[model samples]
Target: MASATVDSGGIGRASLFLASGTIVSRILGFVKLIVLAGMIGAYGDSADAFSIANQLPNTVYVIVAGGILTAVLVPQIVRASQHADGGTAYINKLLTLALLILTITTVVAVALAPLITGFIGLNLSSDQLALAIAFAYWCLPQMFFYGLYTLLGEVLNARKSFGPFTWVPVLNNVVAIAGLVVFAIMFGADPTGSRSAGEVTPAMVAVLAGSATLGVVAQALVLFYFWRRIGLRFRPDFHFRGVGLRATGRMAGWTFGMLLLTTGAGIAETQVATLATGQASVFVLATAWLIFMLPHSVITVSVATAYFTRMSEHAALAKFDLVKTDASSAIRGTTLLIVLASAVIAVCAYPFAAVFVSPFDQIVGIGNVILAFIVGLVPFCVLFVLQRTFYALGDTRTPFFFTLFQVVLILLGVLGCTQLPVEWIAVGIAGVITVSGVLQAALAAVLLRRRLGGLDGRRMLQSLVKYLTAAILPVLLGLSLVWLLGGTQQGGFAVSGRFGAIVSMIAVGLVMASSYFGMLLLMRSAELQAFLTPLRARLRR
Candidate 1:
């Protein structure tokens, strides 16, 4: 297939659109989290049950198709597009195959929802297990929708129509938030886990899990308009024997293996968290993960997605130098932003976490977890871009091997944490994630260097050091400011209300962020200037 035309403005503009969409989506997503936390406290049985059940579909989907759809689909679609029919036959057949798989998988999953829920919530009370099973009946069907959304979105991505894929999640979040609002109004706050399984009506289950699934369906279907605008029409093609699917199937073997390893680590982490008795359940760990992914989704993912297709095209054309350049720029840019973000988050971890959990104790619990997770933020972001580089080069096996190693490390780390107190279990999980990220990043860097002949390591490391150094003073100053403003070491701050907490976070955040950027400017950081150039140009206009 002919390569999709690269935007002349390069990754900057593409990243901007993706980043903007992600910013809005993340903001709304956080709002949804806050509402859900209010409706059901983060650590309670209901919260854990609902979280595990709701996430089960995603887990199953990833185990089955997520990695392939993400790591293998774009390049396959790009190759298929070179066909005489503009890849239409291949795409239709692939889509048909995906839909068939999703339908079958969803049905089987929904039927086994109770057993799945039981496994995920092994540590939950029988009532919690039953509630989770009920929720699963409504939520498990989301697997099909999730697959649909990914298929549509990746096709758009291959066509270089990126905005819809990034922005559609906003609709999902909005619908979910609306449902949460209604659930809160109807049931009031159920944060105490006081409601038994008998009290949760079928209508309640439909409202909660059904509404969530509705959001996924809407997110998937809304892409059809964009699909039409791109001049692509979907036609079901059942004759899949001769399309390029054989190659994709070959690639998917390794991709699926990689996901299995990653998912195994996730399950291990969840199980370990479940053993906890206090505020360290899987829900709490998941919330912290949400927070950890905020900067990543907005920055690392945006830049990586923007560059992936171009890089793939370059690799396809044997332009190894261009591929190297793109990978280097993305890594450096993502590292700088994520490092800064990690510093800011670490300093404000307490108040930031306080936004999601009410009551002082829960605040401290989630806050500590956030801090622990922050340690891995930079490594995780770096590894994200590097993995995409591998995907673009059509080398899924390397990542699989590296990830298998990382998962081994993660399992070891989590097992070692089994002796910690319940409240500290979340911290242990965070630690495991951080350790795995570091190891994964290191190994990915090594492999990427070999693949590219060399990856400008000296330059990248220099930037990393400078950024880390620049972040230190700002973080210390922010901590001091927070301390002076009645923030406790335990993650709570003196605030009149949520509004007060927001005010404090913004005020402190601005001052800290300014300090970080100011230092970067003073140090004459080239990457910082490159980052600011687009904004500067827009402002000059």
Candidate 2:
């Protein structure tokens, strides 16, 4: 049997679990968008208002997530696991502290909803700003529950319960979708975004934002079940003296600072995007971002997440070679798929956008944003791996500098975007972010290389070149199929309706995958065989 160090099988299985869950979650997420767009319409005042409000919690969650879930929790927990008491004492203390912070943060966020709304939606009209504040009052409470989910989920992830972390989001989406259906039944649909901020009623606010919060509550609470199954119990431990939490705090402090910089940049992006609020700005950017995240979430995140725990373990033991090996493997594996995904998705951008919104201009709006965002997809994944590699090595300060570097770039680029046409503002914001991501990833890789002594650069470059070469034909084929279906033309089959868009996207995706796979097969790519090898083994068994 292969040594556990070389046991790609375990990571592959974990990746499969993470990917499968992410795939379902993202699909439901798209469905939720479809329902949301149907109810409020994309690019409408109400949609942008709600989008701004809803995104507030996510922004807050990302802030909380930047430190604990991403940087501090796993490495610390992996270290604590070797304690004589099995780390229960550390877990209890950490959980108690995280929840306390979350509760305080949530209350404060809810109280300052108006202030938060004003800041994020600085340039909105009074009516729209008022609507966003109203929704934020209801929606910002999700900040606590979102933190709750991450706090618990990260603990589970530290314990290697990866499934529930990714799977529970499906429940969140399902509950939210059910709420959308009932909301539509009660209030009627507005898929064309005909409703303006002034037209929204209190009852509408209660149901829509309320249900969204409820979904987050459910998502956070359900993790306790998995927590129990894994034989972990939680108690409120307040004696925070000596369980090694000081070090955790030190790690989280740097991560928090880094994420604050990132959040500032996000705030800048939102403020800039809001300049063209009525013309595919805020809501369009939100929608386009969700589309852009699907492939990253499913492939890059799944693979990177699986590798993270392993890296943490190896790093705790000062095993840099294994960490280097895992990092390279993760980067190469994710890049291979991301390259293909980026190419195909960019080609099918219009059709994919058509599935969410019907208006030709809106489809084009979202499609253009997709193209802008997807250009950075490969680097985005690379950064994901590189950052985690740093975190795995228990170094948060370095990641902060690189993140700060990107944030500065983003802020400057977003300011420049304000001079562009209103219709192009969202696309410009996305393009700026993509460019910043590419630059950040490069800086991170260089930093990581200096620290790790090397990152298998020569082989990684060769594989990257190979993957790009292989994707050329598939990209051309996807573009041709898009043209054949007239994806860019209004009322064409690919953009005519939701049904046609789905069919066209599916057909085009299959053709592209086949061509890409054929190319890889001819080259005998290790990445391709590694993907197939597990499935082939399962079949034989």
TM-score of every candidate relative to the true structure: 0.96, 0.98
Pairs that collide, model 2: 41-193
lDDT of 2 by residue, 1-541 (tens): 0111113458887887788899999999999989898899887789989999999998887787535566889889999999999899999998898888888888888888899899999999999999999999989888888888888888888888888889899999999999999999999998887788898999999999999999999999998888888899999999999999888888888898898999899999999988997787888898888988999999999999889999999999999999999999999999989999999899999999998888899899999999999999999999999999999999999999999999999999999999999999999999999999999999999999999999999989999999999999999999999999989898999999999999999999999999998999999999899889878988999
lDDT of 1 by residue, 429-519 (tens): 8988898889889999999999999998899999999999998898888888878766664433533246656877787889878998999
List per-prediction Cα lDDT, in the order shown.
Answer: 0.85, 0.90
Which numbered prediction scores highest in TM-score against the true structure?
A: 2
Stretches off by above 4 angstroms in model 2 are 1-8
